[model samples]
Target: MSHTEQAMPRRAGQQGLWVLVAVAVSLALLAGCGDDGPTDLQPDAGTEPEVCGPSDVWCKDQTIDRLDLLTTVSTGEVREEGTTSGEFLTFVDSRAGGLSPTMSYSYLRFTPQGLTPVQIHDQESLGSTDWDLAVRRYTLRVNSGTSGPSCVSVANTPEGTTFASVTAVNAAMEFKTEAWFDTACTLIPDDSGLNGPLTQLGGFWAYTSCVQMTGRVFVIRLADGRHVKLEVTSYYEPSAQQVCNQTGSVPQPSGSGAIRIKWAFLP
Candidate 1:
């Protein structure tokens, strides 16, 4: 073949190779920017993630950059005891070193049927919006303010208002965040069992030496703006029920930290 003819064919082959490489580069870029890509890619700092789903419900607003450690924190097993009055009834074994000096919290998310346990126990737990509530023995915390960065908050009903009675969230009802500290940054203690520090659902259980349900119902506003009415039904198992009398002593004290709660979505 002539030299010019040979050079033309080689140039054509080189052009075809370049076209193939360009196509592959485009595909790789598309794949990297896809929705199912790795979570390591950081977005703008402090930028809130977009509201997800067709219903615009909960936002998977986990700030990957804010977390110092990416290790998976441990959690305990959760039990489903079925439903009660169109509400979900769940039993959480939150006995992670109950009353011990060093303890851990069990994180959980609310579901229509029951509570789904979320295993995130490290610094990443505070930055992730996957969990709605965290329980450590008697104390409880929601994902907001000092607790985390999701928009979860709570509003308490009247003194005698039952969970079933709270059909809708009134416009005047004030929503409060999970506050574990006061204005001076001092750690607020649950000394009175009434949550003097202004925690949203802190008063659900009262401790007068003996733990007992205060029968308080709270309407929790979830991250997606949906409301749920929740109440702590029992602190012990149903088989071994115990409550303090007029005095603060329990004659037959049942096993503690068997947290049982009943909750349902509100209108």
Candidate 2:
């Protein structure tokens, strides 16, 4: 069955969704080290009715705001499979190095068909020869926006307006939760490319200090074209140095945190 067909009819008041963490024994997948690009397999863009009635599962009576999802710190183990209450697939970055308090990555795979999320070890492992298992993916660039708590944003695109790989979303204007949405089913895409938000010197995913991610917001585009706005509400783990004595020692698990998000399938 297709993704849209599998979407369950849910209301907006759902809260306190707990995400369970699973440790996979698979090897770590390094980034920017391989030739494999993002998977080209796009989910079937099933059509939605022009007018959604109150009982339609695909229709949103009201846009859900500030829904919280929890993730455990990255313990060097891959979050091979997990699902959020929002029905979004969440995963941890399975790189071998210890999770840097300042630098870390995770992913959200949007499969409307209720497909289980997969742990991606590296770029080359993104797509398989088997067509049915292939999934479209994006990199989660976790960082502090402007001068607030750590915010979650996408690294591939500079802004959420147009889909591109070279530019990143502006940290100043587009990095806050309020900037991504206006109301139910209404979204304003970030058209400002270099002019939108600016990241720290090393870029969006670059880590500076332990408390750098305290406040920020991130907007991500799912495979099915839905937009999710995210904010890092809290951190549940300690710094990498605090967890591991030496950089070489098996780094302590780190990336887990609390995320508050607002999502909708806008036209």
Candidate 2 lDDT, tens digit per residue, 61-106? Answer: 2211211111232233323232445333333333323332322223
Each candidate: RMSD to true structure?
A: 10.8, 27.1
Which candidate has the top score in lDDT?
Answer: 1
Best by TM-score: 1
Candidate 1 regions off by >4 Å?
A: 1-74, 101-103, 193-198, 239-242, 245-247, 251-253
**Would you list the C-alpha lDDT of every candidate in the order shown?**
0.68, 0.28
**What is the number of residue pairs that collide in model 2?**
23
lDDT by residue for model 1 (118-166), tens:
8776465666788888776666678877667677888888888887788
Instruction: Give the per-residue Cα lDDT of candidate 1 at 24.
Output: 100
